[model samples]
Target: MTNKTFCVVCKRDDASVIDMQPHLVRCLQCGAYEIMAIEYLQMTNQEQDPLLSAWIRNRTEEQASPPLLTSSTWISLRASLRIPNLREKQAALMKAFARRSMFPGTVGRYNPVADFPLAWAANEGELRFLKQDLIARQLLDNEYTMGGSFLITAKGWDYLDSIPAGGVFSDQVFVAMSFSDTMRTAWTSAIIPAVRQAGYTPYRVDAAPHIDRIDHKIMVEIKASRFLIADVTEQRAGVYFEAGYALGQELPVIWAVREDDLKNVHFDTRQYAHIVWKNERELEKGIYETIVAVIGRGKSH
Candidate 1:
């Protein structure tokens, strides 16, 4: 907490601040997050964006370490930040309720003022409106007390169950790699089976029967996939480009390369851990373990 007395993300002054190794700011509006003083001070009041605020609030609600924001991490996050559409916001808010009230008819308190970020709302008024909309739709019970508590209706659970695993990327993994004659074994013997073993659908754009524009199809498939596996074995520009697009969408990208090609990776992406393997056997095992670690085993086998 710099002596500034206002939240770095939303500029709300009433937030609780703890000056520590990574300054902890428990913002009622933006939720809790750890930020280095340097980065906190670097943010100007004009930099506030609700999408960024909502994402931080989401990380806080996950009950994991509050996401630590730094210059490097912000580059991609800031670029990826976009206002979510109305239906998406409502879906997120309902999912938040589902997280709290696992079963129907369980009351959970919501603070429109503090938890507005949960709905990706710009303010408390918007959050109130969203709540009322849900109530009107019979997806949530009306708040019973002044505390603004609510419960999901049975219909709400049904609605949630009907939705996909995520707004984007529903347990499908997009594989970005060289489709070269030498790399044939890498795709068939390594990447494909590795993704399948991790319980997710492995999709290589070329493997699909799409007569549409290839680039359009690639972009569409990338958005539909949960994460990306970028095998830079041949250091192909297409693989790097696809991985960059995935990063911009905030999808996790696992890096892999042939041991001999490891030295050829681009300078910017070199910082990430690479699963350098001597052969397809090692590549398969490495990619499988990394997928399990980065993203837990997917439900769609």
Candidate 2:
């Protein structure tokens, strides 16, 4: 008789077979494997087996939690997850921490155990798995403790640099404006067209098909955009926040306001040059010219 085998899914030898069946095994690691003889053969020949190929693809996808969509900040750091792999995700997370640690006025080293960005993880368990994986691979320095600090190893930096560009931040322009009927007309009739003429895609948060946390989505769009066009015609607080955030990221902000409403613009922002347009034609013409002058054709930064 042959020796009892391990779970085929996770390769754990400790898993027990169902009802003493040698062909069917349960996985202890993921608690998800219930392998039949045919399924086992299919899994082994996944490339040649269509059913097993689809199952494996689906299972691999299900491993990623729903709420943990990759963010544009990861793109800006040149660490976006282009391929679905543990090492890539770990590298992106580590690079995010490294960026925060280098931020102006940052006093201490990043403590990933305590300071892992929650926005990047779906839950505490997912975060823990990432940390443990990195530690196991010797890419991060620290024990699994509350006060433990995370310092990337030299190998970790090499891994980060090895990641290919994900191109999440393409030639895109984020448009910030009021959602009123007039502003909507302005955007659809003038702003968006001008952006396209300037050779960049324009995106507005309200136009997105999927409903998500509004602020979170907006921030993601801002980070992904090559530049920002802020129309403070109504002086909406959200518009101001978006513009200010873009400026803080050192992204170029193209300020605009209605000719009549220019007086309502904040005192501080008024210091910068702005496009004061009286009508849609003026808005379109001014924005197109400004984009051509400020961001030149074919340039993404």
Q: What ranges in model 2 sit over 4 Å off?
A: 1-169, 298-301
Q: Give a tens-digit lDDT track for model 1, residues 1-301.
A: 4443588778888887788877888887777777787887787444777777887886566443466777667677777566776777788788888887746777877776778888788878888787788888888876642346788888889988865543332567889988889999888998889888998878898887645678877876786678889988878999999999999877889999888888888999999999999988999999999989988897654
What TM-score against the true fold does each predicted structure earn? 0.55, 0.49
Candidate 2 residue lDDT tens string, 1-301: 2334554433446655554332434332333333445555544422222222222322222331112112232133233222324554465466555554553223324433323332134334666788777767866654422234456666666765664332122466889999998787799989988998888878888777545577777776677567899999999999999999988766789999999999899998999899999999999999999999997763322
**lDDT for every model?**
0.79, 0.61
Winning model by lDDT: 1
Superposition error at 159 for model 1 (Å): 1.0
For model 2 the local lDDT of residue 208 reads 70
On the 0 to 100 scale, the lDDT of residue 47 in model 1 is 71
